[model samples]
Target chain A: MIQIKEVVKTYPARDGGSVVTALDGVTLTINRGDIFGIVGYSGAGKSTLLRLINGLEMPTKGEVIVDGKEISRLKERELRQARQKIGMIFQHFHLLWSRTVRENVAFPLEVAGLPKEQIRKRVDQLLERVGLAERADAYPSQLSGGQKQRVGIARALANEPDILLCDEATSALDPETTASILQLLKEIHREMGITLVLITHEMSVVRQICNKMAVMENGRVVETGMVSSIFSQPQQALTKQFVKELQPSTQGDDTSGEVVELPLGDADKLVALAKEHGIRFSVVSGAIAGEQDDCLRVRVDGTEAQMQAVRQVLCGGERAC
Target chain B: MLTGIDWNQVSVALGETLYMVSISTLFTALLGIPLGVMLTVSDRGYFWENMWVQRTLGTIVNIFRAVPFIVLVLFLFPVAEFLVGTTLGPTAATVPLIAGAAPFYARMVETALREIDRGVIEAAQAMGASRLNIIWKVLLPEAMPAIVSGLTVTCVSLISFSAMAGIVGGGGLGDAAFRYGFQSFNDGMLYICGLLLVVMVQLIQMVGDWLVRRLDKR
Candidate 1:
């Protein structure tokens, strides 16, 4: 479990006359055994937040409490000890190219001062878990991108960390490779019950694996909630844009009607209400005739007054509509 | 031409050259590597980031590196005399040789260490490796191939420095050439010493290249 409390991180600008705030009063709590995904555009402070969790970068202000220890205030020696329980993977895999796969996996174990024989056994088991046992003798350069990530995963797990922070672990891979890597991460989480904190720019990555999600913009968490609820009912403008991008569009060129999305069970009630109000409505996509879908998207043809009325009812006085 | 050359003296000079180069190179590697690692780690944003240490070491290495080997040897005559009790043989010449070549090799080692990916070092840090462990296990191992290549270049330069050492009565092939060849006008001794120096350089380069090839995985 990790709790980031009102953290603010700032770096002195290159000019040395001013500062750039990377994270502005951001607060987040990631529960144990969670696949928590932080999504943002570049420079949105997601990576900064991830680094804070492991004490890799200390906060300019506020506390980072991981497993009940205040990481930001710890000494370097104590921080190193704390870091052994928190493993991280990077976008580039960050593998030691000079070392063989087996040796690379043995690195953390060696750092932890495990015996040579025990390290060998642990590395063997980890390689087997990641399915990279056959390529143990190869250097990082000899492996493909996906295989390199598998090695990264095995190395991260070598210390048996309770929390695994993935900083765009799949961003460098092809889509198929990304899928396989995500699947691998999912399996690792299930088997180990380790807490996973993943920061990525790819919304689909969060959707595929994360149970909880946070949307960040300009060093602030604009939205954070369960993934399912956020997808169904996005609160902020940025969250709405992210969700809209994932929707399957049906009215491609026809910009003539007002499109509204609601739960599938409410579609009939909305249709009867539209008939009572003498408004014409048609199901544009999602859930066509006896097939159940999570969301029911409908296009309504009406005047400005009718459209406003329909929006008022659907939004239930919320500003998102 | 071959009959005019003193084969016994030429063999002795070759042995002296080998002794000077081998001894100076050993000391150079031992001193230069730690100096180079210090220069790298004490740099800005590195694990041991200390501005004072980095700048002080940088200035020292630069001062030693900027001086020509011949001038450095002459300047260090007292030091060689004090350290070796004489400034007249292959053994005494190593004082100036290491002083000149160690800084030169340290700079090269710094460059080799810099060529490594910073992310790899950061990855080691994230794994909770101690700073000493990171230096020995990660930085040194990762930069080894380039370091070995740099040492090879340093060794070749040390060979030439030892020849300069010979010019000042530090007995080696250069002394033989100057005494028996140039002064006596034998010409055969001069040609033979030149050929031996060339052969030594070639052998060093071949071994260096082979080691680099064997070590580099990237």
Candidate 2:
């Protein structure tokens, strides 16, 4: 379980005068056993939020409580002990290239002061769980990117951490590999009942595994809710933009000249125009690039009368119509 | 040409060179590596992130590295004599030799450490590794190959620096060449000393390269 209360993080500019706010007055709570997703574009402070939870970076204001203890207030030694229960994986995999896969996984156990034999057995079990038993002896550089991330996952899980923080864990991975890693994470959460908090820019990632989600923009939480509700009835403009991305493209044409924008709930209007006027129409494009309006482009193929009716509907009896 | 030289004296000179270079290299590695690690970890946005400490140590290393070895030997002569009770011979030369080369090697160590990805250090922290564990287990091992290569360069540099110590009665092949060849006009002795120095540097490079290749699994 984790609770963040009005947390703020700021960094002094390298030029030595101004301060840049990385996260501003953000408050959120994650329940135990919940796989929560924090979705944001780059520089939205999602990664910074993850670090606060792990006690790697302290917040400039407010508190980050994990497992009912304030992590920000903990001293270095105590914070390290607390971090033993909070594991993390990274976008870059971060495997020690000089170390073999097994050694990489075993490193935490060794650091925890486990017996050598116990560490070996646990490492073997972890390697087996991640399906890296065969590659245990191989160095990280010899493995593919996906395999490297798998090693990261195994290494993070070695200590049986109560919470797993994934900072863009799947962003560097291909779609298929992302799916498998997501599935593996889901399975781990289910079996171990560990809390999973993943920060990502990928909408599909949260849709695939996260039940609860927070949408962040400009270092603030724009919206937060169940993934299904957010996908269906997104409230904020930024939230709607994210939801729009998940919509499958309705465009069915090989060639098109122009595109028109549509707000949500306009598919019926296009369908009616086509049915009443006997016009052949298809939704061409889903959303345009860097535009506020979430739109759908439609291609019309019809007679002059039908075209005129469609134009009237589109223009709403305005000057163009 | 061979008959003009004393074989015993030539061997002694080679031995003295080896003794000075090897001993100074050991001291340099012992002192330089920790200083370098400190410099890297204390840098801004690094693990320690102490601006004043990083700047101070960096400035000190730069000051030492900028000084020429010949001048450094003379400049440190009083301190070397005070520490070792004499400013002459190979033993006394190691004092300035280490003082001169340690900062240079520390800079190399800093560069080697800088080559490591910061993400790896963060990952180690996230895994509950203490700062000591991260430094020892993660940073050092990850940068081992680069550090090894850097040490090779440092050792070869030390060989040349040790020869410079000969200007102040620091006995080595340089002193032998200065006394026997350059001073006495025995060009053969000078050539032999140059050949031996070159061979010493070559041996250091070969071993260093082999060690680096062995450690670099990536």
* Candidate 2 clash pair list: A262-A295
* Model 2 / residue A147 / CA error / Å: 0.7
Docking class of 2: medium
> Residue B189, candidate 1: how far off, in angstroms?
0.2
- The CA root-mean-square deviation of candidate 1, after full C-alpha superposition on the true structure, stands at 5.0
What overall lDDT, based on C-alpha atoms, would model 1 receive against the true structure? 0.89
Write the residue-wise lDDT of candidate 2 on A1-321 in tens digits.
899999999997777678889899899999888889999899999989889999888899999999989997888888888888898999999889899999999999988999999999999999999899999999998998889989999999999999999999999989999999999998999889999999999999998988779999888898996564466456899887887787666344523322233443566877888677777765644432123224455556666677677666674431120
CAPRI rating of model 1: medium
> Lowest-scoring 10 consecutive residues by lDDT in candidate 2 chain B?
B1-10
lDDT of each: 0.89, 0.85
In candidate 1, what are the lDDT values of residues A1-321, reduced to their tens digit?
899999999998885677899999999999888889999889999999999988878999999999999997889889998898899999999999899999999999999999999999999999999999999999999999999999999999888899999999999999999999999999999899999999998889988988788999999999997675576557899988887777657255434576677767677767776977788886654532222225566677788888877876675432221
Q: Highest TM-score among the candidates is held by which one? A: 1
* Interface RMSD after interface superposition, each candidate: 0.7, 0.8
